[model samples]
Each structure stands twice: as structure tokens, then as C-alpha cells.
Target: MTVGFVGAGRIGEPMVERLLAAGHQVHVYARRADVLERLVAAGAKPVDEVRELATCDVVVSCLYSDAQVLEVLPAIVAELDGLLISHTTGRPGTLQRLGHAAIVEAPFSGTADAVRAGRLTVYLAGEPEQVATARWIISSYAGPVVATGGRGTAMRVKLINNLLLAAITQATLRGLAAGRAMGIDESVLLEALAVSSGGSTAARQMDARGGSENYLAAITPFLRKDLVACRDAAAEVGVDLSDLLAAAYDGPMNLGV
Candidate 1:
């Protein structure tokens, strides 16, 4: 399928590469001209204007936030009768506001390398037909496409998943710090937890770090926003989210500007 992408940042760039590698014609738009060089060299057509992408079969956005998505909608609304799948992790509500377009929320799990290796897990939410098309496009590059629900539902699942991840990641970090302070081998404790009741997706991420930036970049404004969204979503449903909020703000300083 012909695919268009907006916001060719870290996540967006990798996604474009994978889509292009999968034999799909990709058109990309980014604010910075320099970022498009690799995509251009890799056979992607660089779209100078964002509205140009409206002509594609599907346009996936991995933008920084909900407001950014809103800002781009007017430019392409007339051109986007086709599906708009949002690869951005935390902006389901923003997608819902685009009533003129058939919006799909698809948040991916795992990194760019995993995506290149066809190992990323993508959760999709949208209209049934749009979702089917999205699955076809996503499967061309990802490991599995999980259809959680329609439109905002998929993003809600993503928000919930990230909430759990944030809490678990923070707990794991504090555990590691405590273990280190007490001189208990952090590696041993991690291994023990891996086989114990506390073992979880968060522990697995800790194990995956292997002393890399993967874990270090865990605490960021981006993550905090997602977790807070999860809290708000839960509150809307009458569920208390104090614990999650506490976990989110516990290491606020760790999330540097």
C-alpha cells in the first residue's frame, strides 16, 4: 500500500524505513529538511508540504503530541478520505476530534531496531475497514497487529499498558537503587525477580537494558504525559489513580527537559 508519514523524528524515521523496505511507496513530511535525507536516499519521496500526503492510501503520524496532530489536520483534511493511522503513542482523544477523517489509533511497542527486525507489537483501534487496511500495512513491517477495539479504544489500551509500564519501571529502578545501596547484587535480584512473583514486563525491560540508553530514556516528558493520560482516562471511568500518579511523579527530576 502507498503510505505517507508525518513528523519524521526518531520513531517516525524508523517507521518510514521499515515501510519502504516492505516495498510500500512512502511519502514523508518533516519540519527539518536534514532529517529527510536518509529517507530520500532510501527511496522515499520527500513531501515538502504536509498536505501532499493526503493523497496516499494511508498516512501514519508519530508526532510528539495531540496538539501537533490537530495543527496538521486542516492542511490535509480535504485530501485524507483515506485512513489516518496515528502511530503516536498517546493521542487517541486528538484523533477522535478529526471527525472528517477515518482516524485509527495504532501505538507500537518496542524500539526501532525491533521494528526493523519485524518484532514490534502494534495495537490498533479504528473503524473495521480502516483497521483491516492498517493491519495489512502494519504486518508488512511488524510482528503482530492486535485489534483492541474501535477508534479510541486501541489508544486506551495503549495508555493503560504504558501506565503499568511506568509504574513497574519506576519500582524496578528504586529496587535496583536500594539493592545497590545495601550491596546486594542488582543482577542477582533482577534474575530472582525474573523467576519470582514480582517478575513482569517491567522487569523484562530492565533486563533488556544491558547497560544501555534504552532504560535511561524511560523517564521523560513523553512518558509522563502518557501515564497522566492513563490516569485521566481511569478517572473518567471513576477509577482512582493516585498510586499511578504518585509513581509518575516520584522521579519527576529524572525526567529532564
Candidate 2:
């Protein structure tokens, strides 16, 4: 299959590499010349513009946010002949607003490490035939291509997933800080938590990173963005997220330990 890729950042670059490895003819475009050049060196054809990708069988966008996706949608919709698989973790109504039936909502979970290791899980929402049409391309670099019925469902799931991620990580950091103040060694506290009912993926990640400080610093901005998006989504549906927002926001800001 001829696949066009937009945004060759960390996650996008590895996906393009995997597509090339799977024998797909991959065409790529990115504002970063260095990023695009790296993929071009690995067998992807570099396009001068996003619309140049219109000739491909599928166009996969791994951009950062809804704004970036919207910025490129006009050119893609006007010129593309095949499916548009968006991996952006944006608002629920974004897929419908794209106004293209061929567009599939395919927000994913996992980090760039998972992408390179082929362990990323994709949440797919579209018509059955549309999901099937893009499954092979998405599955080339992702695991467990989960179908969630119709458009917007996948983004809803992604937002919920991110909310839990933020909540759990913040809770883990607080637990570690409290334990340390009570005179327990950080490593011992983490090990005990690992086997206790309090164990979580977020705790394990913090342990793996040696401590919470650096990990928290590195992820705070990105996690804050997702949390804000979740808050907005919750507001649209009349759901109150005051407590969740307080925990997720205040903990990071007050991290003096």
C-alpha cells in the first residue's frame, strides 16, 4: 500500500520506519527538515507539501493536537483519494467536524518507546468497513486495534485514559512524598507499593525512572494539556470534574518535595 505520513516527530518517525519495514511505499512531510530527511534516508519519499500525499492509499496523521490536525485537514480533504487515519488525541466531536466519511478516529495509547517496540494500542472508531480498510496500516505499528463503534468514541476513550493517567501519576507522587516524610526510604516504599493493593502502572513507571521528580517535570506540560482537554470534554456533557482537576493540577504545582 502507498501510505502518506504527516508529522515525523518522535512517534511519527518510528511509525514511518515501521511502515517502510512492512514494505509499504511511505511518503512523508514535516515542517522539520531534519526529521523529514531522516525518514527519507530510511526509504520514505519526502513530499513538498501535505497535499502531495493525496495520491497515496492512506494518509496517517500523528500530529500533536486538534489545532494541528485542523490546520492540515483542508488540504488533505480536498486532495486525498483514500482513508485519513488521525492519531491525534483531541476532542470527541473533532472527527465529525472533519466532514469526511473516509476519516477514521484512531487515537492511540503508549509512548514513543511503545511505538518503536510495536506495543502501542490504537482505539479505533468508524464504520466497520472503514475500520477494516485502515486496520492493516495501523496494525503495522500498533497492537490491539480496538474498535469502539462509531465516530468520536475513540477520542472519548482516549481522553478518559489520559485522565486516569494524570490522576494515578499524581497520586503516586503524593504517596511517595508522604512516605519519605515519615522516614521510609523511597525505594523501599516503591517496592512495598509494587506488591500491595496500591500498585499501579504509574507507580511502576515512577520507580523505573529512579524517582518522581524528573519524570514529573518532564511530563507535567503534556499531562496538563490532556487534563485541560478532559476538563473541557467533561464540561460539554455537564459532568463535574472539580475534584479530579484539583488533584491533577494542585499536586504538580505544589511539588516542593
Candidate 3:
């Protein structure tokens, strides 16, 4: 299959590599010329414009935000008769506004390392047929592509997952702080939590980064992005997330406001 890809940035770059490695003919486009150089060098054809991607069998969008998708993808998607797999994590309202027939919201959860290792989790939501068609392309890089029902449903799931991660990550931090106040060694507490009932993915991730400070610093920017997106999404639905947001923002790691 000939695949077209956009926003080939940090996370997207590895995915493009995985696709090309899987023997798909890949067409690449990025606002940054340097971003495409490595991809082109790895055998992807460089597409000069987003609209040009409309001709490919399938196009994957790895854009960073709802604003970028709204600004860059709609016109190109409007021209597409094939499927558009959107990996951008954004609000469902964006999809409703565009109302395209071919888009499959496939917001993902994982780092670039996870993508390179084929361990990324991609959530798929769109027309059933469109989603069924997306599995092959997505499987080149992501392991479990969860089919989440309708077009906007995946975004909601992604946002909800982000919120849970934020809350849990900060809760881990708060727990460590409480341990320290009681004169317990952080490592000892973390090691115990690793095998204890109170342990979580966030705690494991923190351990992987060597400690809380390093892990928080590394993921702060992404946490900021997801939290803001979650806030906006909740506000749109008239749902109050103050308690959740407060728990999320209660620590140093929860950088999103």
C-alpha cells in the first residue's frame, strides 16, 4: 500500500520508519524540511503539500494539536476519497465540525521509543468500514489498535485516558512526598510500591526515568498539552472536572492548567 504521512515529528518519524520497513511505499510531508530529510533518506517520497496526500491509498496524520488539524487537515481531508488516520489527540468537537466521511480518529498513547518498538496503543474510532481498513496500516507500528466505536469516540477515550494518567502520575508524586516527610527513603518506598497493591504504571514509569524529578521533567510538556486539551474538552460538555483537575495539578509534575 502507498501511504502518505504528515507531521513526521518525533513520534511520527519512527512510525514512518516502521511503515517503510514494513514495505509500504510512503509519501512524506512536513512543514520542516529537516524533518523529512531522514524519512526521505530512509526511502519515503517527499510530498511538497498536504493536499497532494489526498491521492495516496491511506494518509496518517501525526499532528500535535486540534488547532493544527483544523488548520491543515480539513482541506486536504475534504479532497480525500480514501481513509485519513488521524493520530492527533484532540477534542471530538473538531471532528464534528469537519464532518469528513473518511477520517478515523486514532489518537495514540506511547512515546517515540514505544512506537519504534511496535508497542504503541492506538485508539481507533470512525465508520466501521474505515476503521477496519485502518488496522493493516496501523499494525505496521502500533501493537494494539483499539476500535472505539464512532468518529469522535476515540478522542474522548484518549482525553479520558490522559486525565487518568495525569491524576495517577501526580498521585505517585504526592505519595513519595508523603513518604519523605515521614523520613522514609524515596527509593525504598518506590521499590516497595513496585510490588505493592498501591503500585501503578506511573510509578513504574517514574522508576524507569530513575526518579520522580527526572520523569516529571521529561514528560512535563506532553502532560501540559493533554491536560489543557482535557480541560477544554470537559468545558465543552459542561462537565466539571475541578476535582480531577485539582488532583492533577496538585503536584509538580502536573504542568497543565
Candidate 4:
């Protein structure tokens, strides 16, 4: 398949490399010349303009934020004759601004390392045919392509996923702190939880990163971005997220709630 891609950053660049290695003809674009050159060196064709993606079989935008997606994606869909798959995790309304192109809203879960390991999980939302076509292209890097009905639903699911993860992370951090107060080692507390019923991916991640401090430092920026997006999205729909948001903000991580 001939694929057009944008936003070759930490999360996106790995997907481009996987697509190229899967033998797809990938035309990549980035605002930065350095990013363009890096993707080009990874066997992707560099495109100067986003509109040049119109001629490809599929166009995928994995930009950093909803702001960037809003700024960049309308150009490709304006002339695009093929499916457009968005992997950015943000507001559902963000996708609505891209016009009536055949679009699959696929906000994925998992990290850049997950992409490199072919273990990324994608929440898919679109018309059936568009989603069916998107699964093939997305499978090059993603493990599971979970369908979530019509457009916008995938982002909603992703926001909930991030919000819940944040809550779990906060709860785990608080529990570990309590354990410390009780004279238990924080690291040992994490290790015990990894095998206990209280175990969570968030707790395991803290253990993986060596401790709470390093884990908090590493994920703070991305977690803050996702949590704020979740809060904003919930507010737009008039959904009360106070209970969840309170737990998320109650931790020591300082995610800028």
C-alpha cells in the first residue's frame, strides 16, 4: 500500500519505520527538516507539503496535539481521495473539523516502545469500510485494533483510558506512600503489588522505571497532557469527572491538574 504519513516524532517515527519495513510505500512529512531527513533515511519518501498526501492509498496523521492536527489535517483531506487515519489521542471534535473525508479515528494506547515492539493497542472508530481498510495499515505496528462504533468514539475511549490510568497511577503512588509510613520499603511495596491482587500496570511501570521518583519524572509531561485533555473533553460533554479527577490529582506526581 502507498501510505502518506505526518508527525514523525517519538511515537510516530516508529510506526513509519514499521510501515516501511512491512513493504508499504510511505511518503512522510514533518515541519522540521531534521525529522523529514530521518524518516527519509529510514526508507520513507519525504514530502514537502501535507497536500501531496492526496495521491496516496491512505493518509495517516499522528501529530503531537489536537492543535497541530487541526492545523495540518484539513489540507490532506481537502484533496484526499483515500482513507485518512488519525492516531493522535485527543478530542473527538478534533476529528470533526477535518471535513467529510473517509476517516478512521484511531487514538492508540501504549508508548513508542510498544510501537517498536508491535504491541500498540488502537481504539478504532469510523464507518465500517474505512475501519476495515485502516486495520491493515495499522496492523504493521499495532497489535489490537478494537472497534468502538462511529467516528469520535475512539477518542472518547482513549480519553477514558488515559483518565483511568492516571487514577490508578495516583492510587498506587498513595498506597506506596502509606506503605512507606508503615515502615515498608517503597520499592519492595511495588514488587509485592506486582504479584498481588492489588497489582496494576501503573504499579508495575513504577517498578520497571526503578522507583516512584524516576517513573513520575519520566511520565509527568505526557500524563499531564493526557489528563488535561481528558478533563477538557469531559467538560465539553457536560460529564462530571470530579470523582475520577480528584483521585488523579490527589497524588504527589503534580500532573498540573
Best by lDDT: 4
- What value does the lDDT take at residue 219 in candidate 4? 76
> What is the descending lDDT order?
4, 3, 2, 1
lDDT tens per residue, model 1, 1-257: 77888977876787888888889999998787778888899999988789999999888888877777788866876668788877876655677666765877888777767777788899988778888888888776677789998777887888877777766667777777788899977777777777789777666655666521366565356676777677667777788878766775575226321
Is 1 or 4 the stronger prediction by TM-score? 4
Ranking 3 against 4 by TM-score, winner: 4
Task: Please give, for residues 147-244, the per-residue lDDT of candidate 2 as tens digits.
Answer: 98888788888888877777787788788889889999888887777678897877776676676766676666666667767888899999998886
Q: Which stretches of candidate 4 lie over 4 Å from their true place?
A: none
Model 3 segments more than 4 A misplaced: 183-188, 254-256
Residue lDDT tens for model 3, 1-257? 88999989989999999999999999988877787888889999998788999889999999888789889887677788788888988778786677677878899988898999998999999888889888888898897889989887898898888888888988888899999999999888888887789999788777766778887787777778888888888898899999988888877574846
State, as a TM-score between 0 and 1, how close model 4 is to the true structure. Answer: 0.92
Q: Candidate 1: deviation at residue 244, Å?
A: 3.6
Candidate 2 yields a Cα-based lDDT of 0.82
Q: Which numbered prediction scores highest in TM-score against the true structure?
A: 4
How does residue 151 of candidate 2 score in lDDT? 86
CA-only RMSD, every prediction = 2.8, 2.6, 2.0, 1.8
In order, the Cα lDDT scores of the candidates are 0.76, 0.82, 0.86, 0.87
